[model samples]
Target: MDTLTLKIIFMIGLISSSAIRLPHQQQNKQNTVTDDRKTPLETGLLLLVFFGMLALPLLYVFSPWLNFANYKLPLWANGLGVVSFAIALWLFWRSHQDLGENWSPTLQVRDGHTLITNGIYQSIRHPMYTSIFLWCIAQALLLPNWIAGFAGIIAFSIMYVIRIGNEEQMMMDQFGEEYQTYMQQTKRLIPYIF
Candidate 1:
């Protein structure tokens, strides 16, 4: 297939995978508390990353002027992107399923949140972050434009660096020794090797 066709397919898969989480998110929102630990800076960073990764890519795909469409990689990279996207979507779906109503978009704990340690969470403390990292890698591989391709990674990295410590702290506070044991047993974003 042509590069453009592959790019389109990857974008569709990425968007569809993200879209599927909306209902689950909304369902869990009702249980979220007002005590969000995500600071304004973190929220701003997240919004910036979201805009760069999602909106900018779509804009570049449609207009092609917002981003410099240079640095085309090998066709095999696109194939790798497809596989990465598939894994990302699957992991994302499973993570959400495992979290169930315990999931929240931000740093707020749900009313009846329980520590989930099964499915994708069995080995990774942050499988959703892993899935997002996969998305970033896939985005970088699939899109030819420099800004559109690499923005996801740059943005996600910033968000991860800023939020991960706080997230773990919150989990540790809530789950106490149970979370400590889980942390000792699992990696943050990757399994077994991270």
Candidate 2:
């Protein structure tokens, strides 16, 4: 199919991912935070990710400002995007479902936050990041534009790189031996690999 068709599909997937997370985001709002690690860096990185993954892609889809970055992918690449997006949406939903009220957008431990080490978390420490990475990969494949397509990965990689150590430290501080043991038992983003 054409790139516009693929772009529309990508937008639909984006919207669907948002819809799936909306209720969970709202649920987290009511949660009481016992520990908050949110900082200026966190807020800034969030904005960067917002610009990269959401704003830029939407701009590309709805406006002409980004057409200069437009490019083409093979039909097989588009097909692969469909698959990657499917997996991303699934993992995104499942991560939320598994985390439930424990989910927080920023670095904060809820009043009753427990170490999640079952289901998807059983294998990987951050399925949400994995899902986001997959979405970025799919975005690169589906959007057919350099800026919009690859921005998610670039932004998220920065966040992941800067935040992961602190995240593990936070978890280490919170759960101590349990979180440490969990870390030993699982990988960060991938399963049985780096």
Candidate 3:
């Protein structure tokens, strides 16, 4: 209904997204990486993603520094954003739950990594990434400010454009034909659609 309400909704979404990932991030530190595929480009882009997704948004949400760029959205759009955020949070949690020990923050494969083709992974090759994309969409819809609202999509788009192919290649290298078959069967971001 109001600007503050939308910002609060965005904050809730941000916190929810973080809460979904927190446990997995913690667990990942204890796991050894058997295969490290991180490139300098990826490492660097990830930092950009960090700032774009988290830092910039946090600054806008907490401080009035970026308020000049604020815009307005229709009530329907704001509702859609809330729904989008809800779905994004669910997918985020489910992706992590399905991946379990296979999850890693970087491009490295964990020591006991296993190809996940069940649960959320059954219909999507990269549900976690899909969740992030959806979350970005929610960010765009929820946050009225230009920089904080849109940075997630822009930075994540760059990361996804550069990283998805490599990530798929890594999967193919590890699982070979099995991953190939899985790829053919499932869409990258959507189910029954691409």
Q: TM-score for all predictions?
A: 0.94, 0.98, 0.97
The deviation in Å at residue 8 for candidate 3 is 1.2
Q: Tens-digit lDDT track for model 2 on 104-130?
A: 989999998999999999999999999
The global C-alpha lDDT for each of the candidates, from Candidate 1 onward, is 0.84, 0.93, 0.91
Q: Please write out the lDDT profile of model 3 over residues 1-194, one tens digit for every residue.
A: 58789889988888888888899999999999888999899899899899989999889988999999999999999899999999999999999999998998878888878999999999998998999998999898888889999999999999999998999999889889999999999999999998
lDDT of 3 at 23: 92
Please name the candidate that would achieve the greatest lDDT relative to the true structure. Answer: 2
| Top of the candidates by TM-score | 2
TM-score of candidate 1 versus the correct structure, residues matched by position: 0.94
Where does candidate 1 stray beyond 4 Å? Answer: none
Model 3: lDDT of residue 111: 84
The CA lDDT at 163 in model 1 is 87
Tens digit of lDDT per residue, candidate 1, span 1-194?
46578668767976787686998877975774745776798789879788867887787677758544667678788889888988998999888889998888788887777899988898999999999899889888887778888888999898889888898999998999999999999999888888
Clashes of 1: 0
